[model samples]
Target: MIPKLPGLGPLAALLLAAALSAWLGIAGPISIEGLYRWQNLLAAFAALAAAAIAYTAAMAKVKLDRQISDEQLMRRSLAILLKVEFAIQVLRQEARELEEKLGDWKNKSFKTVDLAISEPKEILEAWETLDLFPGDLILALRTLRASLVLYRTDLAKFDSQVEWESTTLASIKANPTSRASVAAKLLIQQSTDTITALRATITRLTNLLNRA
Candidate 1:
């Protein structure tokens, strides 16, 4: 069975008042002038009551709509945060893999040491679309984006160096005694350190998102 609605007692009272006013106008013993005045007064009161009820109903509707809108926004934020967290995990894994690859740089050239990482396009897009509520989470996201951009910039520079090294150091061959070999080793060490730092950043971001 449908639940009875609340706040309808006043409506019933208003209807009863209207019915009584009509009856009084027709059959009450008061003078004609007094009866007319009473009717007019009742009519005015009823109109004011109706206006009040309508205004109350409209306010209730607006409140309900705002509640529904807030819920939708919160759900959307959570969904996007989950996706971004997953992407951060992927980035963490890639950072580890790149670190491992760096260890074998003795056998591979900078060209072969390709970290094979790319921008987290989906995460970035979701971040742009969402407005996370928690202040800490928002700050964490900002830091994460900044870290990602810095990492990418570093990678780009590494790639540019690799290209130049490939052409300039081609004749050098990077033998054990060559200065080029030592420089390559240093680059490998630097790349490993960068990957470690990137992994740490991912971990921090993941923790922040998890808290959310």
Candidate 2:
């Protein structure tokens, strides 16, 4: 019957046998030819085992690198999404503040809308470069970007009109009954209306970005 070797798997048992044969041949007065034969066999098995372990380690490293790369891409994509969302939120607050100023035109001059609204620069750049986000996220960002462009264009037009009308508004406090003063009041009312419309659109865009 084969001898029982507790806790020794097949590979472990083969290595043990090879090591025992080498020890006995070298140190127990075996023949020189016998020792040489055992040494050759042991060297061959050791080389094969080393090569197998190396191949397995190389494959595992490759798989780990791929997984890490995927994780990094995902994290970058999420960061871009959050940044864009934050920018849109800032724009919304600026719009709301301007909306409140419209109620007190007596103290406030008919100045241009603050066109410093944050744009989706980073997210759009990522879309152009990596296209890292999923399809739905890409679609949402595209729509948001277009909306911001249109809003900016509308603001430019309003600012141009305000510049042209500002001259008549200068004397409105001194001579409220004059034609220029009446026209200035009319222009202020128009500006208020424009601000309301812009705020509505900005609110809609904020809601859309929030959903993302």
Candidate 3:
């Protein structure tokens, strides 16, 4: 069994051992060659002790570094998750505005629908950073990305319908016989249907992301 020197370091233990050996040597008629051999053994023991201390210190340092690295990675992931949450809130605000805009189709603005805002930048930015998330979470981000594409498509179609409506709206309003008004209403209804579907998709996806 190895001896445990309480409150004594490697150097202190080695010194005590040397002192004990010297006292023993004095008790007997010590030869010079025997004393030299004992001194050499003590030197070899000290070198081994130094190497053990160094190895133990190195292992401790490695453990500390790995722990710190893991903590930093976890912290970074949490920050990205927070950004995603904030981006979702921004989308919900934009959704409220979209609801108001699509509320009435006929009294809607004569100008073309701007598709620029259909792809919300905030959500996209957050979505890009979700690569670090789990596979299921990454899939949710892809679904949201697809939804945005559909939203943009709806906006583009809405813009085209508005352009077609504007040219014939005034003329059709004057003539009761023209079928242009009917066509315009059909176009509006189609876009409205798509927009309605998109609203539900966004809500479901938002809830899904929140749970994730």
Candidate 4:
């Protein structure tokens, strides 16, 4: 329902006064000078009442508009946070898959390299967009991003050190003393370390976000 304007009672009173003044001017035994003075006074008061009502209504509209804008911003922030939360879970799943692949790294078909060398942006980007209502989530986001970046650096180094020819996997199994086998072992360790670090970071972050 539309709210009644402020000072409705006073506006009604002014209208009643004007009507009474007009009646007095037409029917009552009042002097022209007195009636003119009274009408002028009522006119001035009416104008003031209108101004006051207009100002009040304007202020109310401004306040309502501000409230709506704030609500929109909060919804957007929350949506971003939820997306980041889901992305974090995806990271955990991806890390688990990497762990499984590392155990079977000797297989030619298994993948140990090709991991992205860049930091994950879901957390950091969402952190930038959020209002940080929980506030401590900020630290969690920063820590996670830093850990991922550091791990990616090592992963990238491991990926670069080896030449992934078809003989790479066969040599690791047949001639375990070759340079390719040693490089593959180092990559297995690196991949393991990265997954462990990421699991720890994700654990801490999950506790913060879900309060679990």
Candidate 5:
């Protein structure tokens, strides 16, 4: 592979300079005449080579640092993407559960029942507290909110129908009339269907939120 340097840049330069100076002194003639001729020329050439080597070593270190920085950035980016993927998966699962619950509710009858008896406020609060309930989960939350409102409205309507049925049933009991009883039964059936549909809508919204 690549040759490794013990030190880089300024350190490498100082080392090379010291080594070259030592080599020249050991090899060159000590006489003043020889120092002014070939001895001086040889020392000059050795110094130039050492300087070139030092410059090359310093550039290699710079390149290595840049490579390390790039790798670190890539790793950080991958970690963030993984976290986002996990969040999406969690949202999807919760939405699916909500949908399933809605489907079950659709088959139920609640003509004389008060939806408030279920006290879904606590459930709503729990849903709101989920990690993905706001911001990115806004669309999912809105769907669930609409379903909750519909359920509340249907519950109110069911209560009114129950009151009307109670009055009609009393009248029928006093007069023993079949017509009033039949009319009351029809109203009850319609109210039951409305309540069931409302519950189904809510369940569907919950499922969507879970899946989101």
Candidate 6:
């Protein structure tokens, strides 16, 4: 079992050493007045006890300092983890909402769809406002920014597909020739394929943002 300190500081060790030295001086069988024996013996015992007390005090101080350092480090680490968790949760919620809007737009008319992908900017602003550890917040912010970029790229692709599909539909309606109809149908098929690919990419990115 470990020896527990009754209290802090070197007072206990000093008292213990003083008591032991006094006991030894009184009980030991060494002679006195023979070549400056009694005083010398007491002095030697007191010196030894002082040394022991000093060593104990130094060791206790070291242990206390280490304990304080460890506690400070643990607290800092926990605070960083909490911040990261909060940022991740916010990003995930935003990604979920974007994913739902994208899914809804897949089957709806492009004129009826209003894609507003602005929450990532809000998340980044909120993250910047937080009092975070030096580099940790930057790492999270970079990841969120990258996700937003990918989301924007997908959104742009979807927009282009809508434009291409609309142009193709207008051409088919204006000129009903068999050749024009076949060309418009082909363009429509290609636009549909592009939209499907963009939707899949959006879903994958959203999943990644959610899991982050």
Weakest 10 consecutive residues of candidate 3 by summed lDDT: 175-184
**Model 5: lDDT to the true structure:** 0.44
Off by over 4 Å in 3: 1-33, 104-117, 120-122, 157-212
Per-residue lDDT tens digits for candidate 3, residues 79-134, read: 66555655555554565454444344654344444312344465567566665566
Q: What is residue 174's positional error in candidate 3, in angstroms?
A: 24
Q: What lDDT tens digits, residue by residue, belong to model 1 across residues 62-89? A: 9999877866665666566556666656
Candidate 2 residue 185 Cα shift, in angstroms, is 25
Clash pairs, candidate 4, are none
* lDDT of residue 99 for candidate 2: 46
| lDDT tens per residue, model 2, 1-212 | 99964422345447757777777876886777776877876687667666666766788799999877866665565565556555545545554444444334463344443322345466457557436554545555555556556545445544332422323344433322222334333333433443343344445444644563
Winner on lDDT between 1 and 6 is 1
By TM-score, the best candidate is 1
Model 5 residue 121 lDDT score: 45
Order of candidate numbers by TM-score, starting with the best: 1, 4, 3, 2, 6, 5
TM-score of each: 0.58, 0.47, 0.53, 0.55, 0.34, 0.43
For all candidates in order, the CA lDDT equals 0.54, 0.51, 0.52, 0.54, 0.44, 0.46
lDDT of 3 at 177: 15
179-198 in candidate 4: lDDT tens per residue? Answer: 33344344444444444544
Ranking of models by lDDT: 4, 1, 3, 2, 6, 5
Give the TM-score comparing model 2 with the true structure, all chains together.
0.47
Candidate 4 lDDT at 142 equals 60
In model 4, the Cα lDDT at residue 20 comes to: 78
Displacement of residue 9 (Cα, Å) in model 3 is 9.6
How many steric clashes does model 1 contain?
A: 0
* Model 6, span 1-212: residue lDDT tens: 99975543355456656765776687764345543645665576567667766777899899999877766654544444444444444545544553444345353333212332333344445455444333444444554555555444444443333322222234433322222234323333333333343344335444544453
Rate residue 104 of model 3 by lDDT: 44
